[model samples]
Target chain A: MSYLKEFTKGLVKENPTLVTLLGMCPTLAITTMASNAIGMGAAATFVLICSNVAISLLKKFIPKQVRLPSYIVVIAGFVTLISLILQAFVPAVYDALGIYLPLITVNCIILGRAEMFASKNNVAASALDGAGMGIGFTLALLAVGSIREILGSGTWFGLPLIPEAAQEAIKPMTIFVLPAGGFFVLGCVIALVNKIANRKPPEATGCAACPNRESCISVEKAESTVENTKKEENK
Target chain B: MNKLFVESSPHIRSAWTTQKIMLNVIIALCPALVMSTYIFGIKALLLTVICCTSCVLFEFAFNKITKREDTISDLSAVVTGMLLAFNLPVDLPVYMAIIGCFVAIVIVKCLFGGIGQNFANPAITARIVLMMSFAGAMTKWTAPFAWKEGVDATVSATPLAAETLPSMTDMFLGFRAGCLGETCIAALLLGGLYLMFIGLIRPATPLCFIGTVAVLSFFYGGCDVNFMLYQLMSGGLILGAFFMATDYATTPLTTKGKIIFGVGCGLITFAIRQYASMPEGVSFSILVMNCLTPLIDRFTAPKALGTVKPKKEGKQ
Candidate 1:
């Protein structure tokens, strides 16, 4: 595959968050604030890149059956390194990230990349894939985080944008900060992205029009088949 | 000019178009609207107008953007707007009321395919959303006639949540703190009776719903008549039973299904009122029942005259 294709695909076409819907726990939890999103994204990116590189370099030595547990170990080591660095230098981000900081070890994106790309590709290609996927995940988190922060808390990155006077006049919909608000904003953002990409929503036509109607033994089909078998036996 | 219009099995037609049904509902709602204006002052009418205008505008805008046929003329959005406003406090900010309308029309109604295609009742769902999101603002109920006398919006407890019950006569005449259109039992009854008379709404669902509430509240109140009457007149029980619970799109289709839906609403409303912290439970109850409408319909569907139910697999 082309090197450019490998790097660009994760940005939109196969976005880790929006397209693949991986790592949802952090995507929903830390996205309450734009700053939190950035911190979480950066931390995850560091871990993902390190883990991908390590896994790719050692791919030949690792046995196929034990690759998953081995990959987790590699991911956990890098996660610990990033977590300790964040805690030592940037205490605020560390506190804000909370339990989610350590959760990077099991973030599906890291493990997914290790299994899907790093295990098969060389170190350089795996690292590039990690960076692209990391950037994609960060952008998605930033989009959701910024929207939720501005509307939910009336601030973006700790800066109060909606003036106090205007806030008095109009209360920002506080629901955006709430969990339900997270769901609503996420749904709208995903819908907007899907629309921009000109994606067709899945059709919800019921079983009557299902494409597998021929082989599927629905109630009507079962009854008809039973009747046919009974008639053949009688004849 | 005697041309035969050949068609499928449904050759017979009725005069009840969507527009006619919605217009009839709007007309039925007029008595309560007028009563609310007199009781709650001009703000009630203003809120109603704002909600109706915005709901239609939102529906229109959504249709324009989505390239669908404009359906605002059918007046369903107007009905949804009126119902939503009726569920809110009269003193609620016009913009908040507009937000509720957006939730009702655009999000709940339109996004779910508009009008008859929605799963839950739009107005009920919007009221719940607003109530949950803006708990303090939504629960601040002003006393009856406070706006007329310029009483600085003295917040008072609703009859349902009040320490001492108001006189039955006052409650009947709607001189109590509650949502704008739900206070006046007489006006709601008149509107409901008119809808029944015009055949716009069947009496089965409303009667069963109100009956269940009355019976349950009576037993729950230790067979006290006055307590049962007070429970019946307070909150949105009358408005929800007569107007919302009878919504054609959300309620069940068959008579048996309607009764089941009504009983379920009554049970939930009773549970919420007696146990939950929230003062009122009518909207939540009706919305919950609306969610179960398909299940109710499926279970209570009328069997065809000559068709036997299919046998079980093990039963030859």
Candidate 2:
């Protein structure tokens, strides 16, 4: 794929969390509420975008030897800025995201993009890559948040979407919102997505079609054996 | 008269096979097997028997019903049965143990394409299921035979009970209140040592696991020695750390990878018991570490004999 297309795909078609399965720490840790997801996503996007842009610009100067340290410094700076901004303006998100917000500096997505795409791409392409990844991360967080909050607390964004009776009955997969739950759910989501993406209908009229036919044949054999056993027993 | 032998296409034979390993584990489990029956009364024996019979029966039936290769003769069913029995509380209802057996053999070992393909330990998964569904019975702890009258019975604290916890010496000595097989550290160690001696198994996995936990606990943990010891002793730790966690299919291959796997189990166990809601973390911790076994193996691959470490990760 071309650099520009690769960059754009990170947005949704190959979103980091939802599609690409990169950077689970932030995806699970910060998405407890919708707002936290937004804040965390914003922090990650800012770092992702800044680091990508800076890495692309500095790609010529830094030797391949020390490029990793240079990228880390740039990413760390952006992460610090996000941390300072949150601490001052939005203490709640700052506190809630806690270790995770700063953890964004090391998130595989930012470092991953810097190493893989940003270092190799032009400034414009790097910027697009960052934005794409940011949007994808945000959307994935929103999906997880929506599912967790609705089920876990019977409320979305502190608003009661559930009726009084339904609220009482809501057993919230209380686990889904926990850090562990985030991972388990994330794993399930990835498996499901893989299943869907790799989904295939019954194969027909191709050489590729019949390789796995033995399992079907075995099923037939099983049925016949059972029938034979029943007939013998009845006699 | 000329006779042609056509059984399993075996041209050469060795004493070792999958069935042999499975039977070895069954034999190793006998000490805990006897201990559990003695402590939990005849019901523990009954449950053990029931689980063994049902697990084998279910495995055979499922293999026939599904027309896959029949697996009961391999003794995996027996391993699952013994492991299931080890996980169950002696006081637990026979039917519950049977359900655990069914789940262990049918769902975990069978449904997931069987044996090696199953993502986690069959017995541990079944234990988790039964622990969740039958919380009350699963946690029923019987006092040691000597202490039943003095401790006031009613599920009194285990010997490894944490700071201000129960008797540490009792836990070390295997006289405590906990799961059927998990209460006795010494006996489990003996069994593990025996397995290691006979060349049936190696100690590289569980020793690193238990050693890491002990070292970490001593250095960083404020939870009392007994509490830590109980953590080691109670709830399938030895059975898992030594036997189940050492599964060749599930655990890593290289020595370095095995150590890393052990360390991962320790860290998770410490983190969960310290931070999470669960007090007993062995089964869950082992299952979690088991999930990472492949990744750990991938990352810490050993330099193969007479070769260099491959850049792509798996071997010299």
Candidate 3:
């Protein structure tokens, strides 16, 4: 596949976060902060790119029987290398990434692509795929992180979004930053995006045939007043 | 021929209809509702009625505008109303109960694809939402009538309050003021037992969950063991374990998985109550376990009898 295809595929079709549902642990955990997103994204991207290329090179030498352990050793090597470099140079990203950096060896996205794509593909194709995928994963992490940071922490990339006085007035949605909040937001995003992409008429089950339609006067009262007319007719 | 109406997914249909189950649930919460009003005074009764009415109205309006299938006839709106009332204080401002109703029946319940499809317990989520929005009102526990009004209007602590712990007996008897359905043990148990009798819920989740909590409390809970019993009886445990945690869409179907679900709920509930800063743990624990239901179901699949013991072909 062309390099552009390699990159764009990861962004949408093979998206590690949404489409493939890989690397969910970090995707769900670190996305709580934009800074964490950027940092975690970059770290995972670096590990992914390196791991993919190395795995592609080693694909032939490793026997089919022990290919999993084979891939792990190579991935572990890259993860360790990144961990050392982060600690030596940028200690903060290292500290922030915490044990998660080491745990990257287990991230399903990395191992999945290595097993499914890179190990079978040429070295050049594997590298391009890695960069494409790394960027895609980074984008997802950043997106998820930005949402959480703004809503949960009352900040974006650590900047205060709410005014200082208003901050005290309005309680930050503490749930947004929490683990369950991560699941809720991700679920909503999935449900909403699926609705748009599928373009099926919205599945209806609530107020249309309802007996209390006259009393139920709220925004969900719907656009097509035909529903109201019919509700009244039924009444 | 393309059909004009189509029932959606999980194509498997049980004998139970949504409306019947919901009616059963409302019945389950009724004892609590009645007992709370009797203990807390006419305010609790009025608050519950207001919440129930507003919830039904909100569901109606949401349906009218959305042009979806009318859901109020199913009594889901009623269940939401009753659950909301159950979660709230009798002393709460009427409009706040309306807001709670709106959040329960509208935002949390409807927005997430209505009724069974909602990710969390709508009442609990709404309660939490209200807790955030009106923390003061949510926590303002009124003392019982004490047979005089102005004499003892003091804002004494809830039974959960350590310094002013109601006698375990009083808490069991529903004499103190708390959330509408949560203050009374006998009422909640009666409601739970009624639900069990109706078969809206399996006994395993509530029984195992409560059982686990009792044993763990004996070993780990710092409070008196009987206090743990009172704690289990007092708050939203009955409502959550029987009604919310066992929500069909959110919980596992198999018997063993339900047990594991109950155990997980129990452990998390106990952990939160014992270790966390919060006074209650039922809602958080149920929601957390709700998230894990899919994974639990995946693991606890009942082994097919034939698969476990493959019959020998002609040779046998």
Candidate 4:
């Protein structure tokens, strides 16, 4: 595949959060605020790109049986590096992220891309995939974070959007910041994203109607019906 | 030529259609509606109208957009709207109540394939959502008759919060603070009687439900009859037992399952009232039990009468 395709796929077609659904622990936990989301996203992206590059470079030398352990060691090194940097320079975000920052070592997004994409791909392709996926993850976080912050806190980035005089009249829905709110918002976001990406409605029914129907199964039936009609017209 | 109608099931059916059933429920809710207006003033009536209209409108709009047949004619939306409004405080902002109606008709009902298809009671789930999303507004109950004397109706406390418990007669007469429809046990009971008379709901679920709660509270209160009556009268227990816990789609079909469901609801309600921080727990308890209807039905399904039990392995 072209480098552009490799890079661009993760942005939407293969998004880490909304599409692939990796790294949900931090996605749901730390995306309560826009600033926290950005901080966490950027930190995770940094770790992702570095780990992908490291894993790709060492793929030939690393033993096949213990590749998971080696991959974790490499990912952990980058995570610790990121953790120290964030703690030193951005102590506020460090404190806000708390245990989640170090917990990034186990974030499936980083390890997933490292194993699935970087282990087999060339260095440049792996780097581009990492960047694509990182940007995708960051964008997903930003989307969820903005929604939660605006509705739950009446702020976009810790700045009040509703006027102070009107604040008492229009109290924000405080549930969006809580765990249940996070789930509702996440579910809605995923639904919206899926709707946009898959423009064609599933054949003969809605999602709720036939829980057993697979997407491509419907597509296959539709395509074969069309081909049969075309052959009849020719005859 | 003679006409023939082919259908599934036992073939023989009652005259009752979905629309008729829903219309009966709407009629059954009238006593409580009148009582709420009497206690809370004309604002209660206005809120009910707004909620019911918005619910039907939302259902119509959703069906139009989704290209499905309009189900508003069936009157389930109206029933859901009335039930949702009944659980709310009379002083709730109209827009907030409308929002709750939207959650009920659109999210809970329509999204789950509309009437007869939802997994839980739409009104119960919508009330829970509104409770969680807008706790302060949702819980702002004013003193009964406060609206009558033009006394500032901003006082916020239910019967559970009052320093001195209101007299049982006062609570029964809807003179105490509670949800719009729940404060009036007399009205809810009247409605319940009307429903039972019309055969809209069976006595199994409601009777067993209130009975379990009464017995448990009596024992828990050290065999105090007043405490038992107080527990039964307060909260939305009567309203839930009569209207919500008996929802056709959310409750079980078999008699045995309905009894099991009622016992489960009663136990959960007592536990939540006694242990949870929230003063009242009717809607929560009903919603929780609604989640278990399928399981309860499965376990309580009646076996075939003629089927023989299996013999012991050694005997076989």
Best by DockQ: 4
Worst 10 residues of 1 chain A by lDDT: A208-217
Candidate 3 Cα misplacement greater than 4 A, ranges: A53-74, A116-125, A192-235, B1-67, B89-156, B167-177, B184-233, B237-316
Q: Pick the candidate with the highest TM-score.
A: 4
lDDT string, candidate 3, B1-316, tens digits: 5678445334668888778778777877888778877777777788878888898999889988998778889887887788778787766777778877887888888877777777667777788877765667777777776325644334666666557667767877778766777777887888888887877778999888888887888776565777667667656776777777777777887889999989998898888887888777888788788778879888887778767644667954
Q: Cα RMSD (Å) between model 2 and the true structure?
A: 15.0
Q: What is the interface RMSD of each candidate, in Å?
A: 1.6, 5.5, 3.4, 1.2
Task: Tell me the TM-score of model 4.
Answer: 0.89
All models, RMSD in angstroms: 7.3, 15.0, 13.8, 6.8
Model 1: per-residue lDDT, tens digit, A150-198? 9878899999998877875676677787887888888898888888878
The DockQ-derived docking category for candidate 4 is acceptable
Which clashing pairs does model 3 show? A31-A145, A207-B63, A209-B70, A210-B70, A216-B61, A220-B65, A221-B65, A222-B65
Candidates 3 and 4 compared: the better one by TM-score is 4
Cα lDDT tens digits, model 4, B1-316, are 5498343222458998889989988888998899889888998999899999999999999999999898899899999989998999988888778878988989888998888778789888888888887899888888887876897666757876567889989989888887888888998898899999988899999999999999999999999999899899998999999999999888887899899989989999999899999887888889998889889878777778998765667844
Please compute and give the TM-score of the first chain of candidate 2 against the native first chain: 0.77
Native interface contact recovery, all models: 0.29, 0.00, 0.00, 0.50
Clashing pairs in 4: none
Query: Candidate 1: misplaced stretches above 4 Å?
Result: A84-88, A200-235, B1-12, B219-224, B313-316
